[model samples]
Target chain A: MDIPSYQDMLAAHERIRPHIRLTPVLQSDHLNALSGARLFFKCENLQEPGAFKVRGATNAVFSLDRDRAAAGVATHSSGNHALCLSYAAGLRGIPCNVVMPHTAPEAKKDAVRRYGGTITECEPSTSSREETFARVQARTGSEFVHPYNDPRVIAGQGTCAKELIEQTGGLDIVTAPIGGGGMISGTCLTLAKLAPDTQVIAAEPEQADDAYRSFKAGQLIADDAPQTVADGLKVPLKDLTWHFVSNHVSDILTVSEQEIVDAMRLGWKYLRLVIEPSSAVPLAAILKNAERFKDKRVGVIITGGNVDLDRLPWTEGA
Target chain B: MDIPSYQDMLAAHERIRPHIRLTPVLQSDHLNALSGARLFFKCENLQEPGAFKVRGATNAVFSLDRDRAAAGVATHSSGNHALCLSYAAGLRGIPCNVVMPHTAPEAKKDAVRRYGGTITECEPSTSSREETFARVQARTGSEFVHPYNDPRVIAGQGTCAKELIEQTGGLDIVTAPIGGGGMISGTCLTLAKLAPDTQVIAAEPEQADDAYRSFKAGQLIADDAPQTVADGLKVPLKDLTWHFVSNHVSDILTVSEQEIVDAMRLGWKYLRLVIEPSSAVPLAAILKNAERFKDKRVGVIITGGNVDLDRLPWTEGA
Candidate 1:
């Protein structure tokens, strides 16, 4: 994998600027009062298509040649990535075929449909998703936009960090949730070039800490059956993303599911912002290890706000 | 009642600048797409003490003389106002007494306690609340800050519309929820002076449409038994408030309980912001009568985001 540079990230920001929202970097007075850190939240949860997925999806869609673009786009996602790609494709007047699992949330499905995306449901398994996507690609000859593993997507994701640095100067540390590590990889690359002094930390839930274990052990670790409130961080670390993380990121930390739930509730109660469990990963990390980051300037990437409103994490507990 | 002009609102902005947040004006791309009117939300729900009640409370607290302020403050409220006053008083190193009904939500009671407020729980009736507040004031010699009846509070609330107008650049119309008419009075006063072309409309839940009825009948109308999701709009229009609403407010529209529920859910889902039923009134009114404001630049004031998260309005069907 050719690692995208800061120059590439700057270009991605320019490319996706028209399609994506430069979501506000909210300064949390309440959180700051609690932790004694000047925390800036990169609210990607409020981004277009309801996630930072748009940054990557939009970059991928526009990166393709005119003929390839005219041929349309396709992806396999049961979450924000699916909705984002669909929305991005619609903006560009290109067809979007989202192959989602049958068990995908009704809200997510409705969002994709509302954005004018054509959906094809398959079994809720990696093998089934791949097979369904291949079949759809073969039938339509459309380009497949990998959710996180692709270089173009990773470069696009880096644009989030680019904006963060531009908005809040040089940060002491930057943290983001790690699944397949697309967001963190892009974040690392952007920080490595722009503010090398700023430590890039991978915040992973303990239920699915494959990325943390892999980074710590100096080897890729795959989870057969991972579990966590942060559904977006369920995916295992890939080779390309691990390469970026290993080289650029300073450390990786894990937080409990309970901490994630608490952080989500705290965000709503204090920030009045409805953040999904996935978006709460960075906050969970901060709350769990407040000592390490006290009095430092920190930036937390809130990845998305697409939660199952019917079954919130807090209610399931006490 | 002395009418607050745009100049008074400007002064109020300067006075409350240190205490209040210049809450962001957020846009719901999805809602705008669905409703046809380009809707811009003034996010006062994200204000301190978890509501715009702080704006009025803070203004009132600071407007007092140092000697009068040393005597501390007192108010009767079910939740937000009490919490706001307590928080503001705590910040100013002064004492606060809150006269709350025992029937108020546990969360609000907890918040008032968290801010070091002395709670005086009374029966859930106007007579009881008034009697309890007066007794507390007589005993403690604390200054009374009426939630909506105070001109300083109205001036402070009007600063929201002042900020909204500055943020959105003279909206076609400004819609705010009306209870005691503090926010709407401030909004109307600001709009009437600064942007006379911009209409100011009051939104009320049909279950407690005292303000709406009064606006139409040209007389203060208090519902004998008002029942609505919006607990904040339970208060009837006072004489001073009624005068402002009657003179300056363009119209007062009523929305059903279902609309309020739907708007609250939509706010949580789309805007990723936790808004209470009272905050949803403006959005509810917008949905109920979208045809009236079609293709217009509409500004809706989100009154507050404090809600009982354990049992969300979204889960409890309309």
Candidate 2:
């Protein structure tokens, strides 16, 4: 496995610039007062396909040589990455084949289909997802882009943090919610090279704290599945993402399901942002541990906004 | 009433630039495909207090002489204007008093209080609001800033359209949801001078179509307290707003309650914005009457985003 450097990140950024948005950085004085920290929300959620995953997906899709592009691209994701890759592939006039779990949000499934991706449904388990994706990849002979673990994908994701630092000028701390750690790894990769003095905090849901536990134990902990209101954070970190998380992250914080839901509502009311539970994890953690971030200029990465509006966390089982 | 001129709007733009966000203009390819119009959404919903009403309110609050400002500011409103005035007054550290109806959403009422604005509730009728407002003004000696009727407020609202046209370079048509006609009048005011070729269209709910009827009749028509999901657009156009609307507006379009609700959900699903039903009105009108705007660049001002999250239009009575 190769580690992508800052130079690779810069190259990937140029490769994907035409395909992704330089999503705006948002600030809420109301939210800043709530935690005694100035919060700069890097709104990757505003990306046309509604996620930061577009950067990575677009880079991976656009980087393929003409012959490889002709074969198309394939990926297995719980949600956003599948849709984003499909969007990028569609832009490039190529096929995108996605393997998604049966339990994935209906909204994400619809978005993937809207972007012209063909979906193969698998049982809601890691083994099933891997097996299904393998069969699809074998049949199509498409270039496999791992959701977060690929060097090109991580380098592509790094562009978001690079933009965040530039947009805000600088920040004392940068926090992002951790699922498979794609966003966090990207943050670490950028900060370690560009803004070494800045701190990187990874937030996790208490019910699905594999990343948190792994951070404390000094190793990658695997979780096939972990049920949480923050559906995006159910998966565990991959090896390449673990390399960055283990070396560059300053802290790992966890928050309760209720905290996540409360933060989600607060984001909608105060930020007027339609954010998912995963995007709320960093905010929930920040408010929960205010002292650590007090008086600091903090950048909170709003990873995605592809929420299942009908089945919001606050209205579970309604 | 002295009409606010294009020069007055320019002064208001400069006066309120520091206080208001030059809100972003967003475009959605999906929505454009659906409507066959290139829609430029001026996202005033992303304003700090979550509305374009802040533009007028900030101008009104800040324009007062020091001696008059010391007496503070007051207004009667259904929702957005009340909270926005409160937000503006809070910024200047003045006593902001507001007269609101009993039927206003809990969320808006809470926002007014959050900004330290004292709310005096009255029956949800024009007469009751005026009577209640008079009493409050008499007791507090606060300067009256009529939501749309005042020249200062109209001038301030015009800045939104000025920025919208500047941001998009130019548009063939500009559309906004009309309640008391503050936003529409502003669009008309700006375009009549800056972009005379640009047509201004006002959208209204079919259930509360006073503005549409008034446009057709070529005279002011009033709706005392019509019921609609777009709580902000229940009020009638005032004398000052009518001056601009009667002179510059090209057409008035109305949509059904169902159309409004569907557009609101589509905004959430596709735009991923937590927009109020009022903000969805223009989009609904455009889709319902697509042939009129086909292949043309249209600027749609998203009025506000201070929505009652728990009681979304789609989840009513859940």
Candidate 3:
């Protein structure tokens, strides 16, 4: 497989510019005081489909050739990717087929349907998801867009850091939650070329620390459905994402479940942003290791805001 | 009471500029689709004390001369005003004494304390508030800053609309939730001079519709103790606030408790904003009257983000 170059990311930015929002970068003096760091929150929670996934989804959907685009697109995601892919496909007047686990939150499924995606549910397992996805793609003849593994998607995700560099001028450090290493790889991709001095850090839930383990062990590590409140970070890294991670990432930090919940509440309380558990991991890392991030100009990617409101992680019995 | 002129608002803006945030104006396409109106949210929820009340509090605190400023400031509020006043006074290195009903949320009281305000708790009654405020004022020789009825405060709140008009170029209509009528009066004060053609609408909770009733009757109608999920809107209109309401407000609209809760959820879900029940009222009004707002540009003041997370209005059995 060919590695995605900086030029590919630049192209993805141009292609998805009209289709995506240049979400605001917010700063909180209160958060700064608490963390002892100057934090710039890239609020992709404000994205159209309420996550950064739309960047990749839009890039993939819009990059397709006219004839192939006519066949539509397919992806298997339990959350934001499915919703965003549907949104992007709907924007281009194409069909989007989403394969999801039956146990996935109803709110996510409803959002996918709302954005004109057809849902094909499978049993909640990796094998089931892949098998169902293959059958669905074969039956529909849709172009397969892997959530975090595709070069096009990674290039698209890289645009977020590209904007962050331009928006904040430059940063001492950049941090994002690593699920399948999509956003972190994108951050690495952009910072590697544009701002080589900037350190790229990946944060992950301790409950699902595949990326952290993988980075430390110097090899790709796969987790089999690790449970975490940060549902978006449950997936492990692929070879394409692993390549960027191993080459450019500065460090991988892990935070406990309680820390993630605390950070999520802090985002809502102090930053006045509605962010999901996955989005809070970077802040949780900062809180856990204030010494590492102290006094640094840190760009933290708020990955998404697509939690089921009825089942908020901090709620009683949740 | 002296009427607050647009000039006062201009002066207030200049006075408070260094102390307060010029919060971003956010737009949600999902909300626009749902309400059938192009909405520009003036996000005062991002203000220092997490509310637009800081605008008024800062104005009132900073406007005082050296002699009066040294004596400090005092107010009786069960909500955002106390916390914001404390914030303003802290910024100026002065003491702020707050007289709050014991029934006020512990979260609010803690916020006031956190900002260096000394809290004096009273029985949860209007009469108790007045008596306690008088005693505190006499003892401390502090200048009394009325929450919503003071001209300086009205002028301060008006700056939000001033920024909104500039931010959105010019909105066809402006909406704010009416409590003691501070924010609406501020909108009326600014729009009456700056954007006279733009209609100014006041939204109220149906359960505590004193503002709506008072508007139609052309007389101030006080509700002794009105119950509402929007705790901020329970206060009655005073002469200073009523002056602006009666003269400049185009209409008063009210929404049910359920509508307020639903709108709050919609804000959290779609706008990705952490807004309080009171802040949701303007959007709730828009939802309740789609015909009136359809296809028009509307500016909605997101008043505050000070809700108790442990007891969110929509929590199970809340």
Tens digits of per-residue lDDT for model 2, B95-188: 9999999999999999999999999999999999999999999999999999888888888999999999889999999999999999988888
Candidate 2 lDDT, tens digit per residue, A1-318? 698898989999999997788888888889999999999999888889898999989988989999999999999999999999999999999999999999999989999999999999998888899999999999999999998989888999999999999999999999999999888988898999899999999999999998999999998888887888787888788899999999999999999999999999999998888898899999999999999999999999998899887777777775
Which pairs of residues clash in candidate 2, taking residues 3 or more apart in a chain or in different chains? none
Leading candidate by TM-score: 2
Q: Pick the candidate with the highest DockQ.
A: 2
Model 3 error, position A292 (Å):
0.4
Off by over 4 Å in 2: none
lDDT string for model 3 (A223-297, tens) is 877888888888888999999999999999999999999999999988888899999999999999999999999
DockQ of 2: 0.77
For each candidate, report what fraction of the true interface contacts it reproduces. Answer: 0.69, 0.64, 0.67
lDDT to native, each model: 0.86, 0.92, 0.92
Among all windows of 10 consecutive residues in model 1 chain A, the one with the lowest summed lDDT is A223-232
lDDT of 1 by residue, B108-199 (tens): 88888988899999987777888888899999999998888888778888888888989998799899999889889888878888889999
Q: Model 2 chain B, poorest ten-residue lDDT window?
A: B309-318
TM-score of each: 0.97, 0.99, 0.98
lDDT of 3 by residue, B1-318 (tens): 899899999999999999999888888888999999999999988886899999999999999999999999999986899999999999999999999988787778888998999999988767788899999999999999999999999999999999999989999999999999999999999998899999999999999998899999999988866788898887889999999999999999999999999999999989888899999999999999999999999999999998787878888485
DockQ of 3: 0.74
